[model samples]
Target: MNFSGKIEYWEQSTNGTWSLFAVNPSDNFSVYNFCGKFGSCNLNDNKLPCKCLPGFMPHVPQKWYSGDFSDGCTKNLMSCGDTFLNLKMMNIGRKPEQSHQVGNETECKELCLKNCDCSYTYDEKSCLIWTQELVNLQEEYVEGYNLSIRVAISDIEPTVQNCEPCGTNMIPYPLSTSSNCGDPMYFSFNCNTTSGQVSFKALGGTYRVASIYQNTSKFFIQVMDVGSLRLNQSLPFNLTTPRNSSSNVSSRVTDDVEIVWEPPLEPLCNLPADCKD
Candidate 1:
């Protein structure tokens, strides 16, 4: 049972989402003390199976042993700056079969440095952004796609990589609540605090929405009646957030989100924190 190996599980990056299982036995993966615990690894693996990103390091090392590496690594003792990129299970041997073989790893960095719009780079593919925001960042194995994050110059050795945040896509949103039905009806929204991109869906059915507000990374709504809620004629719509690793979109409202749903009123207002009706 000493089967071990690092498998590429591209959950978010490219390919929509393809799950790859680690612990390859036929592939010659060896046995290690604790492997594949961080991502999807096995107990027996030769390489550094589980590891934190550049800006991050091991959190609870003991928990990491059992594979509970959720609280991966904390930010390194360096401020946000530039640092040489670090390459892991990349070009050396792994890559997406459906990926476009652009070039070598060096070429990847060359591309990132070439475009000012490029917010972040990974998988040997440069995410050339016409706009800002590098959202939806996930980890996986790809040929020639080792990513060295833009850490504080203090993180890496003097001769290593260097980088800094463009500070463009870090948007913010505020929450708010309003009341309508004679102190009984309430409305509120919270921006989804997810990076890169996100899809927003209205909770209730058709309701008369009066506003689709946006504040920093928060979404505000001033709907009228509880008949039909929509971004426009569309009930239960979706709002895809930006594609930045550090982006959040939440629905906000005033103390009691001022909601004027038509027809049958609503239930969210039942909570005392929401309304008094």
Candidate 2:
């Protein structure tokens, strides 16, 4: 019988239970890459079942909006200091072209990072890496492996040139323009060479940098007189400390608020006076 333009056959087993299955052209979701590469199929989403993965944008917005995801999604060109966007609870379809046995997640990540061809990595029982475009990605009811996809740093946030001293305030570690300058993870600060002004990037707008105190692990950001700043009360655009650092970050608002960012003290104490035994 045909229902909703779909041909189906009801087959009864010996137990007297009948199963209805599609005969001719089945549902679009039944086929792999139904939503195209770098796209995911959401069975729960009736209105728009297809969406690009995080760190990706629809290749063709016009076609994507028209219920055609054939063009799929695309990512920006990545550089050496690129970071990963962790996609959790993913169905990550297809066998990995490259696989390896690793001791831990860090080892797994390092292996993928070394190879420019490695686009994504998964470290479950072992390390799994993929070089080609990801396809047939699905999000089932249950949780799945965590997949780390390499993405450009600029895509994650707004970046500016590294500043030793912007205007009057000194920029510290982990706040550089390029991968070679400082820890790229903390490259969230922007330096304006023309005006000699440094700004802290926020979701809504940029905040003028006031001062940085390495001893107290704090920095200050003031609202720019002519700029817009939309701050989230919950997060308030806090700087994330590097993973290896042992400092516990804390922030508070004052008439002039100071933010905390502490890296390993050894690097800062290299000067003769500071390093005196």
Candidate 3:
């Protein structure tokens, strides 16, 4: 069958009727169906289908804006420091260049840091490290593993504490349950206990806080009916897409998305005396 400007494969039904099977670009099975190397594809994002991972910029900006991600992305800042940003629920469709058996996550982190060539690392049952340029790293909305990418230390903001508790979820300093609790620049969360189950609004939508990273100021949240949630791009938080596309599924399932809010990078005036030029 011909669809738009592309040809698609079709199958004949029992009644001898032809039905569309797959088409290039639109079909999920096609090569480069998702994003290209280092470019993440979000089907929900009608305006921007592909985006570069944090701390990286499109290698060929002109081509990327024209919907060509074959060149992928390049690191915005080249110098690697002690800090690494954790991008959770990522589908990296390749094997690590090196694998190690580490006792704990801390050891896994240290191993990756010591190697200047290491660009990514993962710790589950064991530690896996990648010493080459990361590619085909897709952000998954459903199930996936965390990929820590080496970043410059200047990019990270120090963690702070303020509020106490909203059920089991701890309200960190920058994020508060009350106006008096957190920074006014950031919004407040409303904790509802009417159902005897604690739940709060991360920004505009309701979610159950799964985990909080104090150092990174990131939250792992589980939201129901994610399809209905319209994400606001102006907000500081970042949302992950479902790992596997459920476009054809009739029923919806609960999934977790990582929400991270980082305060703007500190100004040059805020830098320490010795660190300044």
Report lDDT (CA) for all predictions: 0.32, 0.58, 0.57
lDDT (tens digit, per residue) of candidate 2 on 1-277: 4755656778898999999854654556766687888787645333346767544678899999898888888874545444775555566667788888888888888888886646555556488888778887775425655567776645443223323444223455556544444455566677665443467766667665655554566666643232244444443235432122121211222223345654632333444643332
Q: Model 2: runs farther than 4 Å from truth?
A: 1-7, 10-26, 78-81, 117-125, 140-143, 158-277
- By summed lDDT, the worst window of 10 consecutive residues in model 1 runs over 165-174
The Cα RMSD of model 1 versus the native structure comes to 21.9
TM-score of each: 0.27, 0.48, 0.56
Task: Give the alpha carbon lDDT tens digit for every residue of 1-277 in model 3.
Answer: 3646567778999999998987655543234524566566543322234666655678888998787777877666777667676665566667888787877888888888887646565556488888776665554445655677776644332233254343223455567666654555446356543211124454357765545655787765555566755555665667766433234321243555666776743323333641342
Candidate 1 deviant stretches above 4 angstroms: 1-44, 88-119, 122-144, 158-277
Clashes of each: 74, 0, 7
Off by over 4 Å in 3: 1-7, 13-17, 24-30, 156-183, 188-277
Rank the models by TM-score, top first: 3, 2, 1
RMSD of each: 21.9, 16.6, 10.0
Query: What would the per-residue lDDT of candidate 1 be over residues 113-186, giving only the tens digit for each residue?
Result: 44332323444343421113222123223332333444444443322111111111111111122122211211
